[model samples]
Target: MLLVDCSNCRRALELPPGAHSIRCAICHAVTRIADSRSLQPPPPQGFYSSTHQHQPYYPPPPPPFTAPSPYNHAPRGPPPAVHGRKRAVICGISYRNSRHELKGCINDAKCMKYLLVNKFNFPESAILMLNEEEADPYRHPIKSNIRMALYWLVQGCQPGDSLVFHYSGHGSQKRNYTGDEIDGYDETLCPLDFQTQGMIIDDEINETIVRPLPRGVKLHAIIDACHSGTVLDLPFLCRMDRTGRYVWEDHRPRSGVWKGTSGGEVISFSGCDDNQTSADTDALSRITSTGAMTYSFIQAIERGQATTYGAMLNAMRSTIRNTDDDLGGGGGIVTSLLTMLLTGGSGGGLRQEPQLTANEPFDVYAKPFSI
Candidate 1:
């Protein structure tokens, strides 16, 4: 066995011979290490020269340099670990018997709940799951109940805790009244009783979930719905083209109510853009229906591959593309999920390019992806 360092997560581990790729136990980053011996530190300077027979001329030493100030700030520490107290709010709605009824939303919520508890180590008691099939009225996906759950997900969110919010259902776009939205439309998550209870607007979601989180807390939002981009009102947005190159934009408008980072780290994965609609399909297992975004998300993780933020987004996109292909060709869709994710919608010549956005600056690949 040989000790090797993980390039992405920086964890040192003993490598078994003939292993080409290994997942980091610390960050779960899968990387191909062809030669573990290459990770060894080089010998100290002058060791080779001193051992040589030939004499070499020594250059004059440069003047001594002053050390950096103690007050000078050092780089920030790694992100908060998910091993801390974890909480999640997962809402899945089929809008049963309604005109906008879906088939896979309820299943999406349950799948996410399972993944959180079994794979991510989230506590079952801490997870609040709301689905349309619930017999209890309070557990229904009503506007007020969803809002309360959103609030509950972030309540008591400490520095080390990992918070997740997932919504799989119909999404819509309404005219922006507050000029906070750049596209002249505010993205919304439709509740079962939206006709009477009203839709959960983007601004309120931000105020309820994103604004209150403290520094060192990590919020991972998986929104498998339409018009989900910027739903969390995070500050940054990353857009990637087919070439895998990406650009970041400041999404907050100049006079927006919520303008910048709230000292916490937020990453949102959306099913589609502000103008597009997400798909509820039955192709996940041929017989069982599920939200396309949710299916791809869970599939990407279940592959047990160590991947960066960018790589994970690409994997989800690839799965979505293949799923669309199996469903017969429609429009040319490019699906990618962002921290503030933007994905392409299928059919009707509409595109739902998934996107990833964040509150603070982060490396897409250098840092290992976590809950």
Candidate 2:
């Protein structure tokens, strides 16, 4: 018998020999099993094989913590010294040669790097990029590499440091066992080896990058992925209406997981809500295919329309909405069918709305948007 944890509830269970799948008695969620024989090393040339597989669930170790105030309140810090530098981690995974391959993720990463270097004056050497095109084995967008990059981005960060994290790839959701998520699902990012190594969970993300920031530091994350809204698990979500009025919805974990930064500021721009799928299409950019959110964001900044947070969000939404109109109203039946086929009938049509989430509430229209 093979002992494995349930994918949903993390309950340990005994699997019969050669079992391909199992349903957890606790959560009743079916967990697929990969063939043990197929767990071979990658090719000598470092090219990944096309065979996709799911690894058995193993709950990650709890994030490190000091004694917490009652109800998971962020503790006042002995702030680090002000080291005002700009650094970034830009990751784009295309899942090359797989059935789940994407065409525009790499392009999105490249464009974002260019934008930061040119527009924001971020030093080129401070930016670390991870994609399939990277020649260094340590620079590939695998799960371990991505985790390391995230750690490097925040390591030794002090006040006045400006940091950015940009990701363009596939995002997914899994059943939330910790009861921290309002929607009962944990958001995840799929690395190149996700089929075997598993996805990077939001809790891990918050613990890694969000919790370590100092008071005067600021981080801006741009995620172009499906189901990415609040992927960083920030404490507040910005909800707005057509009239430009907005409110910050409190998304603090009732489970007291403490998703906030350490008195630092964090703002995230995602491709869509947690329930929606972001699009990868050529319609947004006539020159080359790219993630719609990434393309729209670049355009909004370049066109000088993103002077404030509200203006930036509105501009991105308008660009996508207009493109949807030009594509004959959300791509009609063909897009829906394709989405269904690609997502195993779990997704809907191509309509997507960009989302903004932050650690605290502020006047989005009044706050000057910065890196």
Candidate 3:
């Protein structure tokens, strides 16, 4: 009998390697067998494979704490310092020929690069970009190059060092194999060659980026793509309503109310919720195309002086709503606010809201957003 932990109840159980699922005698919750190595739970129903597929810009599908590794590990170290040079990796894929072609993905990368340098003071030499239009094969946003770029972002990271990883393109969800995701889905970023190169799942991302991060190091991920929330799998999620009220959702793999936090200071600003899609729009007229989240982020920073995270979040939401109104009508009242807000900052319709996930608790207004 193979002894494994149940994905739901966190109880150890014995099962046959060939068995696909078994009922936990302890909690009695039926769990799907994740793998032969362990009795992990299968992914939540509806996922096609371990990767999210591509579709048009329409709809799409799809964290962290170190308090305790639900997968069986120890708590992480303390937070990193606030002083160090900044490094960044920005990727934008249009999937030009495929059905998943996007209008503003490439522009999104360029815009982000511009914002980092002009607004955030990120040096050009420390920034590496992977766009589909690039002539250099090494600079293309293919799976191999993306992985290398990820490694490059975290490589030689020290306390107080600031690292940024941004991906503006399609995102999908796969069946959870490691049982790391509570929702039974592993979010993924589609590389240009995803059909042949395979999607980069959240587990691989966390292991590559999050696990290796030492205490005091900081990673700020800006993901502007469909179903991007929780892509980094950070432990805490920050949600703000239309009124700008903030609530924190603990996403640690462990089953606790408010456990501890991770040692490294990693934060992610995603475009939308797991079940929502991000928009690639040209709301700024010919100013250039851009992902809704990227545009709002820059606009929020530019709208006024630096403020707290809560204020920034509200500003972004308002911008998205106003943009939606400017473009043409409703969808801003619901969760799909990002596209509408950044598209033109009009006041119409509702949309999926943006999400901010981090490893430890923080003051939403303490520090202004800075590189």
Candidate 4:
């Protein structure tokens, strides 16, 4: 039996290796686990084969915590006046191919930048925000910004350091596989000019970026894409076409045709599924558009969900899935939401009325995804 948890949400379960699912009792959410051993070794690109190349993954060593600095949150006195810099890299792949893609990618990156700065407390100087035309988010020319981010992680990030990677745009499966799917692979978010003959695959995500994260560092990778049933929904701000009211697409398509798996030291909050498309809003609001998943994620951390990776992710999943709206079509959202709520373990922080758990085994309509 494998100790499995939702990569998108923080639902936990002891899953039999072959068993596809385990429902969350509280939220009635459904989650699918595909690839295991994804984080065993550090790979060069997306989530693909055993990218570690024989190097074993060391669960980052814990750093000693000394007195909190009066100025910064650092452990002790200011680092030797300049030990090393803590950095973050944010990249959005919007503007590739179509207007929709551009909108989504830009929106996705903007939201992440906010979380890193506003939520994670990273200083603006520490972050590198790379939108469409900007040269490099990670500095590598050939590899995607995500790849470059992973490159830094593999070489630079320390155990206690926090690193985040957020991507918004379009994503597909199997387009660039290292040959690991039983079903045809998936394809997603590529530049407008991304050559059809050669596309980026999920493997690149798993191998280079996800798998290579250094030990001890707490990572939160919030991905807004299709087929991301369990992913944290980033609220895409938009005006209701008919009412002209502000609205949020809190849910995306959560599906499974190909085998999906999870691993690594980081926590992943995906958007929708392979067959689904993330909701994109117009920039007319003049304010940054936020992914519902991202909004909830940051909120949870602020509420103390940062105590553990599992708690934080579950909070995101539960909130997004159960958000109430007058809009129609919940067939997809309901199932995914419930699964996330039930399976998501304790969100670390305890509210007055806790919802569900292995011991409680009770059910309730999850609270809304409001901030």
Candidate 5:
């Protein structure tokens, strides 16, 4: 009998002398055995071994790489504490040194971390940050690292848990082949390595952090990116007009893909409509440049303007609208030229409207906004 390891579970298995392959009863993995001559012990280590130099040494091949799957969750960790816990994953990709680099993404990340830690009472240890400045390779805002950070954000979440995902970066759209999007395009978050590793699509985002939420868990996603209105792929989109009248638009997938939380509540505040582009500008702040939506969102909260969901949304819109008006009117030629140069534009105008989407629809005015 020969002992070999099961390829999948690494369990030792006994093989009959003449058998070429054996199956593991424990894991049902099949292991193929090499020829008997090749299986013999390697020659003793000495000058005699040097005589076999004609055969080149070949090291074992590395482990197979599996592409990330939307449904493949991180390994389950210990259940969270019984009481409500707060955790956040804040990611900002500046694309530093590249043409796509933005001046305020790292700033956005730091501001968000400060907000969560100071105002919202989230522990610093519980927040996972991914940005260009992080010294740790695992914390860099690359495709795999970002995905891992997202998994860590919601792993072992239980009832009464509050989770937050904030991203300030370049967002783009790709053709939707899965038939899951109403607009026929899928929104994507571009990581540092997105040019090579590809963007993180909405389907994977929803599955990774949204779909697995448990009852009584709440999630808030603040996306400061272009074409991010429905980035979370939530089922209901809130459409509000200038008059403040609003209705929830049903955005459920026609292909019957589930884009909702299991039982938890999820709310997303995005930078703009699917067709609109978000701006990275210094117009909102005289001190430093920042993402328009991110700046407005933080300003609203810090200024105590976020009493209700409606109030917060209105405040953010008003802030951006005021900036737009100023830029179009008195900000003058230099400002306009700067805007064009920064945003890669034709010096026309900047029009961006913040958006809100949720797993379920309720009266925005009545519902008090919380993290």
Candidate 6:
């Protein structure tokens, strides 16, 4: 077992046996890496008896990443094996009170699970999927728990421990006192209680959970919601919605707090904008392409078509244009998530994939992502 010098209590403590990660025994402040190898300390029962090292929370493992239903090759390898102690959480909530609404969310969770497992090879045990139905014995209902779990994962995260957080659900704008609905910066995962009681607000999500994460972790978050039709050019807007034609104008104010990536190193995939609706349908159930923005994001990452984050988004938006007739969703919102991601508040030129090679692992330099 590795040891960590709890920055909180300033005491050296041995980590729990087989513990992939743990919070400090004293202040509960998280540790990014195990203690320096030169010094090994006694177990947690030592001098800091009052300091209790709480087990960091981890959400449940996502649903098995099923092989593509129609693919001929058998996943190109064995069912993904767990790598180290990396973790992944998928929260899907599609079935709601009304059958017509069929608000399918967390579907991207399964797709994300497959992407991490098969493509990235995150360890099976470390990968966590938290659906509305799944119970995380180590976790609680608050999104804060998930966020803390993620923080711990990244804090103690090793080279191979990749963290992927995927949420597939509805996007909405909460009306502020100013009489304008603002895009919730801290997007939420639709829990089972979402219909009865809406999920956590983006504000609470960013403040409570996101603000405290470690600085450098390979964490990626994808929200298949539309954050702004203005940041990214809107594809096929429904003529019925009368949502005036999407102008390629940039709406992010230079001084607004919401303009930058506050989530830190975590790339966000918003479904639709503050004023738009991210549509859902059973149409792609028969097609290979995931019509949803999040799924398409995963597919782009998987096929290596979109290498860097920016390139990937460009490819996603292009897919919408190419398959506009195929997906049949006018507004072709496929690249909506990527738009907000790369723009970083400014709608810039197309981003080229970072130079890469077979000898070098895939690396993205998208100016450290944020929600």
lDDT of all predictions: 0.68, 0.75, 0.68, 0.41, 0.75, 0.41
Q: Tell me the TM-score of each prediction against the true structure.
A: 0.69, 0.72, 0.69, 0.48, 0.73, 0.50
TM-score of 5: 0.73
- In model 2, which runs have C-alpha deviations exceeding 4 angstroms? 1-84, 241-244, 282-287, 324-350
Q: Among these predicted structures, which one has the highest TM-score?
A: 5
For residues 227-265, could you state the per-residue lDDT of candidate 5 as single tens digits?
A: 999998899999976876877999999888788887999
Q: RMSD of each candidate? A: 22.3, 13.7, 14.5, 18.8, 12.3, 16.0
For 73-155, candidate 4 gives per-residue lDDT tens digits of 12121222211234566656655455433333455465566656665577776565656555432232123334333444333
lDDT of 1 by residue, 1-371 (tens): 44454566443444556777766433456667753323333345564456564755343443232332111111112222333479888999888777777777887788788888888988887787888677766678887567656645665567888899999988888898767778898888899899987898877777777777778888899999988988877778888757768767777776855644457788888987777777665334312466777866777777744277877777777766665434322322222223102233333322456668787657787768888
Q: After superposing candidate 5, which stretches have Cα over 4 Å from the reference? A: 1-70, 73-84, 241-243, 282-287, 324-349
Q: Per-residue lDDT for 99 in model 5?
A: 84
lDDT for residue 256 in candidate 2, whole number 0-100: 80
- After superposing candidate 1 on the true structure, give the runs of residues whose Cα lies further than 4 Å from its correct spot: 1-84, 241-243, 282-287, 325-351
Prediction-by-prediction clash tally: 23, 0, 36, 71, 0, 32
Candidate 4 weakest ten by summed lDDT: 350-359
lDDT of 3 by residue, 13-126 (tens): 556558777664323466676632252344455544534464223223212332443223221222222223788899999888778777677777887788788767898878
Q: After superposition, how far is residue 159 of candidate 6 from its true place, in Å?
A: 8.7
Which candidate model has the greater lDDT, 4 or 5?
5
